[model samples]
Target: MKLLLLTALTMAAFAANSVLNRAAVGEAGMDALAFGVIRLASGAAALAVIVAWQRRGFAMGGVGRFVAVAGLLAYIFGFSVAYRGLDAGLGALLLFGVVQVTMFGGAVMAREAVPLARWVGAAVALAGLVWLLWPRGAVKMPVGGAVAMCIAGLGWGVYSLQGRLESDATQATAMNFMLAAPVAAVVWFLWGAEGAVTGVGLALAVVSGVITSGLGYALWYAILPTLGAARAGVAQLSVPVIAMAGGMVFLGEPVTGRFVGAAVLVIAGVLISMLGAQVWAGRVGFTKSSSGS
Candidate 1:
């Protein structure tokens, strides 16, 4: 129950990130590169404070530190830039779908014994994403935006995989954000920070960085031990649905039948992926115990 609560909170934070980014970049006229840089810097500061409060000194070197930092930068910059041309809903669908696929592939490469049910669940979730995001009419999507979102998803997947190897969630996340902030700053300078930025946009970015991203990532790392790669990937399918619902509530977007249907399918897929393996394993153990007895 505790784990479930923590996971739910982490997913909510992830969903809130989409809303905040949309508000900052789309509504408040903030430059995507600037927003990304601010978010990384603010997140680093927030995590640093938390680490200081906890008396944990900075320790950044590890087995996958380089990969983690690179992945973090890719996700931050790609996500910010991709949203410039991509619809929020469509962008989220693409990002989550790619993240799931990347993580599943990584799990296979790492020789994790993923069961068949999880694979089917992933397919069902992808189908649901397609159903939700497929254009109904003559909507044209920018190829560059799609590619950027895909890269963002891939980066997030790799970051999540690296998190699974960390012993200290808060410390690791703090170090990653700290290291990535300077890189993001450099990218923002090179990427042309020439867009309008209001106070509201900066506030939104700060909230997203300090709360949704920093603390959210810490919670995610804490929960990763309980959820393996496939389950973790499937579980994140809820983020898009939550983000859509948040849009309806906060952004005044209308909820349609397609969204309702897709949300059901996605939720069902996550449940099946997470629980089916456990149930099957439990029954197998029971049968063996009975036979031995």
Candidate 2:
């Protein structure tokens, strides 16, 4: 139950990132690049403070650190830029769909021994995502935006994979943010200045970085060991549903039948994917006991 609560909170935090980004960039007229850089910097500062408070000197030394940094930058930049042209709903769908595919593929490659039921559930959830986000009438996609979101998704997938292997979630995340901050700063100097940042936008970006992103990512890493890759991939499908609900509340967006149906499907899929593993484990244990008896 504790784990479940933590997972739910983590998903909410992830969803909040989408909401905060949209609020900052879309409504506040913040530059996408500036928002990304500010977010990264603020997240770095927040994590650094936490790490210091914990008396943990930054010691996140691993071969995966560089890869994680690269993936993190890719996700931040691509996500911000993609939102410039893509609707938030459509962007979330595309981003998470690619993330699902990437993580699932990685899980298989790592020989994680995922169950059939999990795969089926993932498919169901993905189908629901498509149904909810699919544009009506002739679809006109911004090519650059689509490609950018795909890159963002792929980056996030890789970053999540790296996080699963971390021995110290906070320390590792803090170190990554610290290292990535410099890169983000360079990007900001080069391109991010194009977008103006209002006081409201900066505050939103800081909140997003510190609360939703920094602390949220640490919590996610802490839980990743319990979830494993396959289930984690499917579990994140809930983000879009949460984001849509957030939009309605925070952005005054309308709720639609399609979203309602998709939310049900997404929840059902996540439940099946997570519970199927327990059932499978139980069945295996029962088989062993029966044979011994």
Q: Per-candidate RMSD vs. true structure?
A: 3.3, 3.2
lDDT of 2 by residue, 1-293 (tens): 57667888999999998889889878998887887888888999999999999998888577799989999999998987887888766787889989998888888887776877888889888888888888777766799999999999999999998887888999989998999989988877876366698999999999998999999999998998767788889989988889889999999999889889998998888877877666666877754311110
Candidate 1 has an lDDT of 0.84
> Candidate 1 — which pairs collide?
none
- In the range 145-170, model 1's lDDT, one tens digit per residue, is 99999999999999999988888999
**Alpha carbon deviation, residue 81, candidate 2 (Å):** 1.6
Listed in order, each prediction's TM-score against the native is 0.92, 0.93
- Model 1 TM-score, 2 decimals: 0.92
Global local distance difference test of model 2: 0.86
Clashes of 2: 0
| Clashes by residue pair, model 2 | none
Error of 1 at 262 (Å): 0.9
**Which run of 10 residues does model 1 get worst, by summed lDDT?**
284-293
